[model samples]
Target chain A: MALLELKSVSRHFGGVRAVDGLDLVIEPGQIFGLIGPNGSGKSTTVNLITGLFPLTSGSIVFQNEDLEKLPTHLRLQTGIARTFQNIRLFGQLTAWQNLWVAQNSPADWAKRGFFSRWLGGQSGVREEISQLLEFSGLAHRQDELAANLAFGEQRRLELARALATRPKLILLDEPAAGMNTEEIGQLRERILKIRAQGTTVLLVEHVMELVMGVTDRIAVLNFGQKIAEGTPVEVQADAAVRKAYLGGGE
Target chain B: MDFYFGLAQIIGVHTLLGLSAYIVLLTGQVSMAQAGFFAVGAYAAGMLTVLAGWAILPALAASSLLGAAVACAVGFPALRVKGLMLVIATLAFGEAVRLFFFNFDYQVARGGVKLGPLGGEGFRQIRYFPENGWTTMQVMLFIWIFVVLVMAILWWLDRSRYGAVLRAVGEDELAAQSVGINLTAVKVSAMTIGGAIAGLGGGIYAHYTTHIEHASFGILLATFALAYPILGGLGSVFGTVVAAIFVQGFLVEGLRFLGDWRNLLFGALIVLAMNLRPKGFLDAPTLRWIRRVFGGKRGAA
Candidate 1:
């Protein structure tokens, strides 16, 4: 069974048809890459899956559960998390606090009464937060506000926050957007490490080197529709994919 | 000393109102309904004790609960709108509640014989301390104790995960939602808690003054409450506390020496404050400085 399945998903922003008749299946523990030209509905698909926007038609199934009715927060509780294409950390919060807030689950909130919750949980939460800070290489700078961090560090902090959710499947939207080569290499290693930990990844990137180097399977989209899906080499050689990228004579 | 104590009591009550406003502001929500909730608390406690013949402590509790109920009712729908629309919705709700209480009519009759008019004209001459055999000093002490308790609770919340989440929601609702924070729940809870705190203040205000009037909890009071958080700096709880004390406690009262010219002085002060320190006197930088002086670590982010 697929970890995530989107069948004939369509979203129309007043006839714009941002994502039209899209069908996709992401297997469990697989690193799936979604790529497309500008305006090819890549981000829209991510939004639809995460319930950021209501789908005009169709269904999204996650772990055999229909996600049509769940709100974005509920979807997140069900072990799905994502990073924004543009970084959106809580700028006023420290790096440690950013990850700490993300670690909150509805279950944790329900477990204790109001006063206990206000006092914050036991040592477990603190330990987990420390681990996440160390994992993101932000332990030394964890006290710094997120807005003060360098861009690359902010991106890493966001990734760490997503991981703190303990998500079953994580979505990365252009994780390597404005990074140097060294940073990209680090991010690739982190993604591989994330996959090794048994969490499935759905990466959406315009950075071909990162996508091709890291993803197990790749899908190409053009004009709100999937144009190709296969291994990286097969997708690279597909005639339609080549035409979509290089532009044919219509 | 008595005069200073009385002034301190008034300041403490306003501080509670300011804290109530601070609660909603923490979620980046601008609600001008604190006066409405304050009225609910005042009337509920007053009527419960005077008419229904209940004890003071129980009446206070009931008032707080009623305030929370009214807030949740208003918040469920009011919070659905955002920015200025939400402000308008809350303001309208506050007016509607005030009008409801103003026009309320209740009469007790025995066998068609008229008893008394207990509604609409406003509950007056509520002799809370005299009738209960309590001293003004005791009541003042009572109000300040709760003030301290509330401050402690807010301080705890400021350091907790709940506070972090509220700040996140305030900073960026979209991003907060993306992280799985329940925006509606966070917002509604903030409103409910804020209303309860204001209601508690109202109960104390009614008992302390030994009177209740509909006109006292008007739009002007609500607007001043809103200004506390803005002028205090929306960044921290300390900002609200300091702003409420300086503005409501000192500045407003201290300007009375100028008599008729006080309003002009107050207006000028506000304008200057807006121009000179738009973020309020007790903002992040100032807070950091205070922390540094006290040898305390960890910024108030």
Candidate 2:
């Protein structure tokens, strides 16, 4: 069975069919790329799958469980997490505090009573957070306020926060959007490292060059419908994807 | 010299009143009838001590119990409402409670049936605990201790996951709901906790004041309570208490200099606190910059 599947999903916003009759399957551990020109409904598809918006009409099955009905957070708890196109970090909190909130820490829950979790302090949660920060290379700035971080660092921090949730699958929406080429190179390495740890990744990116380098397979969309799905090399040679991009170039 | 010390002793109520107002302010809700509930708890303790001839220590303990009980009872409905609607509801409840004593006829006297404090003449003799030197002073000490303890507990709670979730839910309901924080529980818990603290303060206050009158807890008291919190800043635990003491103490103690202008001074103070620093005392981040210019230490948020 596919790790995640969307069956006949469609969404319309006041007579504009943003996504229509889409059927897609992401197999276990595949580094799939969802690519299209501007306003091709890539983000909407991610939102729909993450339960950010209720489907117009569809069924999304994640790990054999129906995910269309679950809320975004419930989906997160069920080992599915996605980063936003626009960063949504809790600005007032510190970097580690933001990361800590993303992870479901079992520290002194009143429902679970006091003495049981009182002794389970910062050291335990700190080690896990430290490791994730280390992987994302954000450990140095862990104590800083999230809002104060540089734009590139903020994107890296978002990656760390998503990893903190320990999701089986991660949906990254333009992790390299505002980064310099060197920063993008670092990000590509980190994404590869993240994939090596057995987390399935589905990336939605506008950077054609970025998608071509790492994506094992690419699905190209135009006007909310998938027009091409093949290996990166195969999709690069496709006439329709080239026509779609040429019609709406960066 | 004796008058000054006595005045200072009386001023101790300012500290407790400030703490009570601060607690309600922290969670963005106020029970204008706190003074009413405060009286209920206080009267419960006073009646137990004077009428039942119970030990003062046990009576004080009973007072807190009565306060919490009354809070839970009143909180049942008041906790569900919000903003000015809640303020009005608590105000009416306080008035109803205060009016019940003088307006309603009571049958007292170990089985003798009489109605009203007017008809029941002998009750006045038993109204107050006999003036024991320094007893009021000792109650004042307990209030200080309780305030410190409450502040400490609240500080820890502010750093906890429960507190974080409450904040999360408060800021963005959609994000918080997505994170699975219960909005209803956060709202009610804040009200109950704030109400409980106010009630406890009221119980202690009863012993210090040594009198219970219908006019004692009016809408003015509620307005003053509301004003104390706003002047300090509503969200910060530290700011609210400071603002509370600043407003109440200045109006009460500073007024000796200008007898007729005390209330005018109070209104002016609220206006100043709100206008100069709308976030209240320490709430404005701008204050930190001001402090730095004036050679003061930086404060935490």
Candidate 3:
């Protein structure tokens, strides 16, 4: 069974079809890359899967469960976590607190009673939060407000925040948009490490270098439609994919 | 000494009101319906004690429950709207509550003297304190007891995961929702908690003042309930207490000699305070400095 499946999803904004009749299937434990030019419905696809907006027409199935009725938070509770393309950390909250707020996994609930889950102090999940901070290289900056962190640190914190949900599938929306080469390398290693842990990754990126170096299977989108689907080398060789990226003359 | 105790009682009750607003404000909601909850609590507790002949403590508990119930009901529809619309929704709710009490009449014969809320005439002679022979000092101390308990609970909540979640929701609803924080539950819970606090405060205010009119729970009181937390800073619960003291004890009481001119200074001073401390009186840096001075290492956030 697929980890996530989008069946002919179409979202229209008053006749402007942002995402028109798109179908996608992501297998469990697969690092799926979704690459597209600006306004190619890459973000819209992510939004639809995450239930940020209602689908104009289609069904999104996650872990074999239809997600038509679940709200965004409930969908996340079912183990679909995502990081925004633009960082959206709680500015007033500390970096540690950011991840602390995202610990909504079923396991987390089972670990503590209702009273402890909320009003109880952070002592129970201290180790888990610290580990996430360590993973993001933000342990030293944990006490600082997320807004005060550097841009790179903020991005890492946002990823860490998503991971805090203990998701089976994580979506990274242009996580490398403003990153330097070194940072992108680090992010690639992070994505591989995330996949190694048996959690599937959906990487949406404009940075072809990171996409080519990381994704196991790539899907190209143009004008809200899939233009190509293949491995990196196969996608690179595709004439249509080149035409979508380059120009009509190709 | 009596005047100081009276002032202390007012400050304590206002602090509760402020803390009530503080919890709701933490979720980035600017609710004006707090005064409505407070009014409900005041009337409920007063009627329970004065007419139903119940003990003050039990009456207060019932009032708090009623307040929470009303707030929960309002929260569902009010939270559906955002920003200024929420404010308007809450303001309308507050006015509705006020008007309900304004036209409310529940007087009953008590030893040949009518004793209950009469429409427009107001609920007078809530003599639980005076009749029980509780001194001004005693009443002030009693009010402070609940004030401290509320502040402590909120302080503990600030250190908990729920506190972080509330702040996260306040920071960004999109990110909060994506991270699986139920916006409705968190918001409604905050609203409910706020209602309980405001209700408790109102109960205390009824006993301390020994009277309450619908006019008292108007928009101005609602604004003050919000202002205390806003002016104090959302950094911690203590900010609300500090702001309540500054506003009630300082501005409302201390400047009384200025008479008619005092109201103008009150407005100007609050504006000035806001300008000086945009994040509230106890913003992050100031809180950090205070913590350092007090030999504490942990930051508020």
Candidate 4:
């Protein structure tokens, strides 16, 4: 069964259709890529799926549950998490603290007495955070404020923070937006590793190299609609995708 | 010693008010409605004790509960608006509450004789301690105990998951929301807690002063209370407490030597403080320094 299914979803902003008639299905453990030019509603589709914006029409079913009525936080609690297009770390908090905040979601804990609620979870949470820090290659710089980190490191920190939520499906919005080539390569490896651990990844990126190298399947969008959906090779060979990108007569 | 006790009592009450402001500010919501909550607490406690013949403890508890209820009621709609708009909404709510108190009238009477009205005249002669035969020191002690308890709770929250989520919401609401932290819940909780704290302070203030008035809990008091967290540094709870002590407890009292010019001096000092230390006296670095001085283990920067 698909991990996520969007049925004829449409989101209209005034007269403009930010995302129109979008149908998508992301199966469990699939590394899916969403690629499009600027203003193609790529980000809007992610927003719709994650419940950041209210759907204009149609339904989004995540793990067989209709997500239309769920708020963003509730969607997250249902094992969906996303990174921002622009990095949105808690700037003043340390790198470790950034991930810690994500891991500290109250819904994850069992209802307990006051003292146990306050003190009981520390050791386990601390161990998990340390492991995440190590996984993100940020153990040494865990003490540094997120705002003070290098751009690549900050992006990596955001990835780690998203992973800290233990999400079943992680939507990564342009995770490699400002990274250098080597950093992008590292991000590709990280995405594969995340997928290998049974987490589905929906990557939205303009970086074709990373997408082509990492994603198992790709969906292309143009003018708020899917132009092509296939394996990377098939998408690369699609005539419609070529026309959309080149602005040529189909 | 008595004079110092009085000073301590004022500092404690103001500190509670400051902490009240700090709580809502934690969720990046600047609510002036804390003063409204404070007023609710004071009036509730005053009217209950004076008219209903209630004890001090029960009056205080009722006042705190009423404060939380009023805050939750205001917060539900008011917090839907963000930043400056929310601030204006809360400011308006505070003014509305004050005006309601100003115009409100409640008459207490036996079968035929007319007793005094409670509202428009402002609830007065609320002598909680005198009836109990408690000394001024005892009253001061009582208020300070709650003050310390609140400070301790806030301090614990600073290191707890609840505080982590609050700080995250304050830093970036969208990010916090993405991580499954319910923005509205955190925001409303902050406001409710803040109101309850302010209400607690108000109950103490009513008993301590033996008098209550609508004008006493106005915008100026709210503004000063809000300034405590900012002037202390937005980074830590201790900063708010220290700022409250320095500004309301020490500086305001010390400036009295200027007599009629005291207000002018106080304003000038605030301006100078802002200029000299834009981040306030106890920013992250200062907090780190203090932690190191006290041999506290430092966490990740």
Candidate 5:
């Protein structure tokens, strides 16, 4: 049994099927990469998995429990966290503030009794937030608002923030979208380090070099359906994936 | 202590109002219906003291609670609407409430209020506490000011982990959900805080005035109350305090010109501030220099 599993999951937008009858399994401590071209339902699948948008049909079982009835933040409490394809940092707050917020108590306390939870005798939460800020290498920029960070540093902060939720499963949507070669290399190292800490990574990236270098396995989607799923070597050699990318010139 | 004594009547009420404005803005809302809530608190408190024979301090507390209750009721209509629509809802509600008070004649002093006639005595009697006199004022102002320090409590909330989720929602609701934040709850809580602050201010404002009138709370006054925290600076609690003082100063100084131009000048300055400094004049980089100038005046040399 895998740590996260999806069986025949589907979503539709009033006639356009964004994600159609998809099935996937992600094991613990493994680096699984999801790849597809534009309009291929990769992001939609992520949204469905995170419970941001409800699934039209089928089932998502996480840690051996059905997740269809769960809310988005509850899923985070269940140890699932994901970053966006586009950067969405809170520009007004400092980098450390970003990580600190992500490290907050579960939605239950924030929901039922925020004042008590926020102000109770618990001082440990504050200390924990401080430790995370330093761990993310953002201690220096703790007071500097998020807008002031450089591009690559912002990406790293995003990773730190996702990690702040202390998720067993971290989903990366285009973690290397706009990085230089050296930065991409550094990102590869960072993703590798994240995995070594016993956190499972499911990355969706278009950077073939990084993906092929880091991902143990790759899943390819072509127009709302998984066309290929195998080890990186088998995935690259698959005839259908080659045709989907290079338009059959291969 | 000397400054508090000098500023006396306004300090507590204005601070509460300013903090409310700050909370409303934190949730990414800009409300200008504070004058109406102030009226609500004043009338409720005044009526209870004068007609119901409630003690002054308790009456004030009850008034603030009444204001919050009214604001919560108003939330249903306003929350469903978004920007400009929400602003309109606030204004319409303010106007409707003012008229409701204006026409409310509860058979207190002389005859009860009369609707449509537009020329009848109001329901509640104007309270006058003599001898011990200013004691109620002192208690009301001091105790409520203590509550306003609860702004520190709000500051803590805004800085906490939950605060980050709210800010994420404020900055971008869709992305916040992706990170597992419930957008509706965050937005509503912020709005509720904004409402509660208005309640606090309303209670203080009522006790200070000792009488509530529709003429005192109109669309224009609501805008002024909302403007204070913004003009001071929305970034810090102290910023809101400075803004309230600045707005009060501007109103007095700007009105020194033409006798009839007070509203016109107030409107123009607020529009200028809203346009030139969307975050408010205090957040402007140049304001740091202005603060230094003021600090110098306070014997900082």
Candidate 6:
């Protein structure tokens, strides 16, 4: 069974059909890539999946359960988490605190009492957060406020924060937007590592280097519709994708 | 000595009020409805003690519960609006609470003398402390006990995961929500806790002053409730306490010899303070410095 299924999902902004008749099936453990040019409804599709904006038509199902009425936060509780296109870290909170607040996984919610989860001392949970900080190469910077971190470090922290939720499917909207080659390479390894842990990734990106290197399957979108869907090699060979990306005769 | 005790009582109550706003402000909502919750607590506790003949402690507890209930109820609808609209919504709710007290009239004959809230005249003779034979110093200490309790709780909360969650929401609502923080639950819970604190403070204020009227819980009180937290900085709960002392003690009481002219300076001083310290009077950096100088535990959250 597919981990996520989008059937004819459409989100229209009045006269503009931001995402029209989009259908996608993401199998579990696959690193899926959603590539599109600017204004091609890539972010809108992500927003729809995360319930930031409701769909104008059709349905989205996760683990075979309909997600029509689920709220944004509840969607995360159901094991779907995402990062922002532009960095939106809690500027006032420390890097450690940022991931601390995102520990909304089912296990975290069920095991701890209400008081212990929220109001009690952080002693019990410090070990877990420390491990996450170490994974993101931020052990030394754990106490530093997120705003003071360098740009690349902030991006890594955001990814680690999303992972803290222990999501089954992570939607990363341009995680490598403003990055040097070294940073992108690091991010690619991180994406592969996330997939190795059995969590699926939906990478919506403009940077072809990371997507082609990491994604197991690729889908190209143009004008709010899927133009091509296949393996990386197959997608690169598609004529429709070529026209969408490089614009030519027919 | 009595004058100092009375001033101490005022500072204590104002600290509770400021801390209430501090929690709500952490969630990034600028609520002007705190005075409404305070007024509800004041009236509820006064009626319980004066008319129902309840003990002061139980009456104050009831007052806190009522305040939290009203705030939780109002939070659902009022919190739907954001930014300036939310401000207007809360400001209007505060005024509505004041008007309710203004037109509210409930009196009962006790020992052949009418007692209770009498509309615009306000609820007078809330003399629980005096009737119980508690001295001014005792009452001051009593108020400070609650103040210290609230401060300790908030201080602990600031160190907890919930505190980080509140700050997360304030920093970015969208990101916070996307990260699985329920915008409604987090926001409403903050408001409810804030209401309880304000309500407890108001109950204490009614007893200390021996009087409370609709005019007391007006826009000015609400503004002051918000101002203390902002001036204190959102760095920690201590900021709110210090801000309350600075405003209620130094600005309002310390300059009393300046007569009516002090009011002008009060406004100027607050503005100047804000200009000099845009983040707050006790921002994170300043707080860190204080801890360093005082030889406190370095890097303690």
lDDT of 3 by residue, A1-250 (tens): 7889999999998978888888899999999999988999999999999999999998999988999999999999899999999889998888988988899988889988899888878676789999999999999998898899999999999999999999999999999989999999999999999999888999999999999999989999988888899899999999999888887873
Output the number of the DockQ-best candidate: 3
DockQ preference between candidates 3 and 6, better one:
3
Q: Candidate 4, B124: how far from true, in Å? A: 1.8
Q: Lowest-scoring 10 consecutive residues by lDDT in candidate 6 chain B?
A: B292-301
State fnat for each of the candidate structures.
0.66, 0.07, 0.94, 0.58, 0.42, 0.87
Stretches > 4 Å off in candidate 3: none
Q: In CAPRI terms, where does candidate 5 land?
A: acceptable
Q: Show the colliding residue pairs in model 6.
A: none
> DockQ for the candidate 3 complex?
0.85
Instruction: Supply candidate 1's per-residue lDDT for A183.
Output: 91
Give the 10-residue window scoring lowest on summed lDDT in candidate 5 chain A: A116-125
Off by over 4 Å in 2: A11-21, A37-39, A105-124, A220-227, A238-240, A248-250, B1-134, B164-192, B202-236, B275-279, B283-301
Ranking of all predicted structures according to TM-score, beginning with the best and ending with the worst: 3, 6, 1, 4, 5, 2
TM-score of each model's B chain?
A: 0.92, 0.78, 0.98, 0.94, 0.76, 0.98
Off by over 4 Å in 4: A104-107, A110-121, A247-250, B107-117
Every candidate's TM-score, chain A alone = 0.95, 0.92, 0.98, 0.94, 0.90, 0.98
What is candidate 6's CA lDDT for residue A11? Answer: 94
The C-alpha RMSD in Å for every predicted model, in order, reads 2.6, 5.9, 1.1, 2.4, 5.0, 1.1
Question: Candidate 1's residue-wise lDDT over B84-129, tens digit each?
Answer: 9988888887887788778865544435643222456676656667
Model 3: residue A87 alpha-carbon error in angstroms? 0.7
Candidate 6: tens digits of C-alpha lDDT, residues A191-234: 98899998999999999998899999998999999999999999
lDDT of candidate 6 vs native? 0.93
Docking class of 3: high
User: Cα deviation in Å at residue A195, candidate 2?
Assistant: 1.9
